[model samples]
Target: MTDAERIARVQLARTKGVGPLTYSRFLETYGSGLAALEAFPERVRASGRGELKLYPADKVRREFDETDHIGARIILSGDEDYPELLGHLSPAPPVITVWGNTDLLKKPCVALVGARNASAAAMRIAHDMAHDLGNGGYTVVSGLARGVDTASHNGSLSTGTVAVIAGGIDNIYPAQNEKLRDQIKDTGLVVSESPFGHEPRANDFPRRNRLITGLSLGVVVIEAAQRSGSLISARTALEQGREVMAVPGSPLDNRTRGSNGLIRSGAILVENAEQVIEAIAPAAPSQASLFEMPDDDLDDETLEFSEEDRARIIQALSPTATTIADISLATGIPSRKCAILLVELELEGIAGSLPGGLVRRQN
Candidate 1:
């Protein structure tokens, strides 16, 4: 990809209404970021949305400048160095800023996450398990939160680890972990999908968790409360077709409820690194293929839909989420055409997409 194409991808990602999924669909339809950027204005006009306000070129340039000043590199979705597992996301992140060893992204990875205010026993187990996994040649992946996340990073720093942060590549949260963050940057890798200087909001952490599970072969839960972020990661792992493993704890502790629930719901029960390794070994061979773009040949055809077809699709959507295939079956439209229509609806703020191809009408 050219420099101009890279800038266009960033601009589309930052645009007000274009989300990750929409941005990816745009790439499929237009063949390149530059082509997508050129076609966006007319699509908006045809939608009768009145005026179109795209992300400014000047702002994109400023973002590029700030990233360079911090010695970080921005990798786009189609870049050769982008993680293969992440590319399999229904709508992969279009741009990610990395501060260290990009090569670690190519290796096998496992995510370890749990409660922020975890028990001492749980933290120790996380650390030791991470160390064992690292020695076994798997790069440990986790969000750089507090308790369990911190322990996981500390143990795997020497072998290999990847810290996927919620904030920008330059922003460090929990202030005390600044030194640890720097240490990982030097020896491992620190990743973020947020912009140059963005601080994380409350909702951003769940978004960050998705990336954690997306970059791994499986997720291991040490101790998670009933409604904790670690549980959210396990759910996302299932959605992404990755393995989910949990360490059982005493029934008396509230911290173990979520993990225990996972085991009951068919998640793998693991006590040590060896068990975790055994659980994921069957999946390793299937996940070894690098991400291949659909069709190998980009479909640059500008598919057109009639006004009646648009009305049928919009009518098929309800407040409740439904899959793309269901919508196609109801509307008698082909699946590819249905997907493209949904993408346009999403860009116009008429619909919203969930993981695993679900779409819903936006209120």
Candidate 2:
């Protein structure tokens, strides 16, 4: 994107009703950030959302300055040095505010997510896993929360860590992690999809969860309640078709319920770092296979798709729910054909056909 494009991209991104998916749609039709910005209001009108109140160039310029003053820089997707795996995410964040050794974004990343108030054992597991992963050349990824998240980063600090903050890198929430956040800025990394200097809100956590896994090859849940944020990361990892691992805890501990259930339902059960390592080993070759997957495996493209194909497949489904037949009806493809496409879509990437009739988009 050009300078005007970046500014327009930021404007649409920060707009009230423009989500990443819709933003991508606008870009797809308009073909440039400036064009997309110009077209946003009309799209909003079509959606019956009333007129779009876009951020003017002056305000967005101030935001850019604020981000730079706070020692954060904007990293747009598809940039030369963007985290390669993160770029592959559908409708990935147009830009992120990053602080610290942003270069570490290229390193193999494994997310360790768990309860904000995790148990001592879970915290130790997270720390050890981070250390071992770092030693094995993986940059640990996690939120900058308490418990397992903090422990994971501490263990990987020497090697490297990536914290996807729920708030701006400059606006450290929880207050207790202030010093650690500073340390990460100096050594590891901290990033958020939100604009510069934006504070954390209740809504930011789930959005940040996607980036937590987006930056990593896999996610490991230490100890999480059924409703924990850690589970959010694990689920996102699964949706991304990245490995999902969980550490088992005793059934008595409510904190372990989420992870234990995940394991029971087919998530990789991680007793130690070995399990996590093995699970992501298949992705290692993809390190070179990041952008342009080798065609030598023409019959071998693991699971890939064109954007147009993705849209057609998604349209064939329902938001409430649907089966292969329903998807076929929606897409006008035969059931067998739909299944074949769904299988390919699953292998190439998540087709959003989870067990138990859950039909949705990967996002």
Candidate 3:
């Protein structure tokens, strides 16, 4: 892509109401970011929403300059170097900033995550598993957090590792891991979907966890409490159709509860790297060909509706999450039209889209 096209992609992504799904739909509808930007106002009006704010060109330009100055590069979804596995996500990130060896992303990867205050035994198991996985030709992927995450990276640093940070590529959280972050930058890879210099907020971690699992062939949970972020990652992995593995911890330990529950729910029970390898081996061939086929072309024709029609669709929605199929049945709208309307509702802040393609009215 040309520099102007690249900048426009970044601008659209930074725009207030344009999320990943919307950005993708815009691309499909307009065929280019510049065209999408030009057409957005009309689209907003058609949604029965007033004028929407377009992201400032100056801000996007400055972001590009800053990324260049910091020696990091932005990888768009269509970029050749973007991870193939991650691109399969329904609402995959439109852009990600990468520092260090982007080539590592091509190798098969397995995510290892667990408790922040991991037990010594759990940490040892994590480190050894990481090392064994690395030797087996899989690049270990993880968030650069404490305990298990840190140990996983340390074990695989010399071989291959990828740290998906919640903050900017330049903003290292857990300040104590500054040295480790630097090591990964120098030797492995550091990735983030946030803008340059942006510090991580409390809510960013779950988003980060998604990328951790999104980029991997599978996820392995070592020791995770019921409410822990590691469980969240495992859940995301399952949602993405990736394998989920867990190490069985002592029944006495609280951290083991979540992982045990996962195994009971059909996650593979794994002990060492060998089991993980075995569990993921069948998936490896398919993942290698994941992006080989073209995605189904989204319908390019824009659906137009009368103001009354729009209101009727809105009235049919409730705060309670409803499936688009049900909405189509209720409103007597075609499924495709229902989808377009839901996207418009999301863009207009009239509705929210949940995982599993459910939608609900926004309060």
Candidate 4:
């Protein structure tokens, strides 16, 4: 928690290829951010990845300073105030930059996500539901996009709301949401995992969606297309063991297909805020128990990988997702060794990890 430790943690997290999962593992193995950074180069070399690229110390320090100047604060993963529900993510963000009402994060939250080009009826439903939920003592959470997200936040601003942005805490996307963003920053909460001044890219939405669902006790889908980011958030909620709820819509509307599909697939079917509250009420005690961070106590005993072993593991992977267990069986590598090799491959940009412990070739 000291200044030096904060800087080191920021550097390690911002380093290319060291994602949330890898960051947590490094912290567990090295016991400190400074120790992890000092050992990273050697670890990369031992993994057959040659030298690793690290973020510059000066750049991280500058980011920290700018965050302070903007009146926002950086909350590290292990901090006392970090949202406990979010901290339970398998690869929870190592750091989140916040602009306001960090205390709202401790309250029970339900995510309301849906199509950005949503119908008027859907938007009204979302708005009213948000207001009702807020009045009922639940903080509403959503991505700060257009349509449903905007309506959700607007409805709950007077009570409590949380906006998880895809860009940096200060970088407002959709340009139109700038004022709304500022309003939330003043009365509600604005959060982002991205560092200062980083503009959101196409790939950042899914990452941001994960945080939306991760910070909540449950996720409710208002109106989503067959393939949409709202569905992605619902999927993440399911993966995180959070409840998923969906509002049914007319079968004629394409926007309702994804949400309808969710209900068919066992998500709770909800119409009003009362149903949503009823669904999550009984889950409160169990949800509290589920917030325990995943244990990272894999045996730290080093295991060397031969060139052939690495090649075989790579050959076993494809663009199609495969579970780590399947990869281990296919390549005759121990599961733990396969995991280490996969992390190395991820750092090298040769592989990527998907939800549900799945892995796929980056190319």
Q: Which candidate achieves the best TM-score against the true structure?
A: 1
- Candidate 1 lDDT by residue in tens digits, 1-363: 788988898998888777787787778767788888888887676566545578898888888899888778998987888888887677788898898898887878999999889999999999999999999989999988899999999989999789999998999997889999999999999999898888999978887999899999899999998999999899888888899999999899999999999999999999889999999998852343222223322233645678888899999999998877688789987766776677778867888987755789996
Model 4 segments beyond 4 Å from truth?
A: 285-342, 349-352, 355-363
TM-score for each predicted model, relative to the true structure: 0.91, 0.80, 0.88, 0.86
What TM-score, to 2 decimals, does candidate 2 have?
0.80
What's the alpha carbon RMSD for model 3? 3.5
Clashing residue pairs in all predictions, respectively, total 0, 4, 0, 0
Please report, as a residue range, the 10-residue window in candidate 2 with the lowest summed lDDT: 289-298
- In angstroms, the error of model 4 at 168 is 0.5
Alpha carbon lDDT of each predicted model:
0.85, 0.74, 0.84, 0.86
Q: What's model 2's lDDT at 291?
A: 17
> How does model 3 fare in lDDT?
0.84
Candidate 3 Cα outliers beyond 4 Å, as residue runs: 45-52, 284-303, 315-340, 355-363
Judged by TM-score relative to the true structure, which candidate is superior, 2 or 3?
A: 3
Model 2 over residues 1-363: C-alpha lDDT tens digits?
A: 677778888887787655664455455444678876665554444334464588678888887898888777887765686777777775567678888787787777889989888888888999999999999888899998999999999998999888898876678777998998888888888888886667889899988998898888889999999888888788777777688999999999999999999999899899777788998888742323211111122231233434565468766654455565566566654443344345434333344544232445454
- What lDDT would candidate 4 get against the real structure? 0.86
lDDT tens digits by residue: candidate 3, 207-299: 899899989989999999999999999988877788999999988999899999899899999999999999998895324322111333345
Report the lDDT tens digits of candidate 4 across residue range 15-99. 8778886787577656799988887887687666776788899998899899999899998999898888877666678989999
Score residue 125 of candidate 1 by CA lDDT.
96
Question: What ranking emerges by lDDT with the best candidate at the front?
Answer: 4, 1, 3, 2
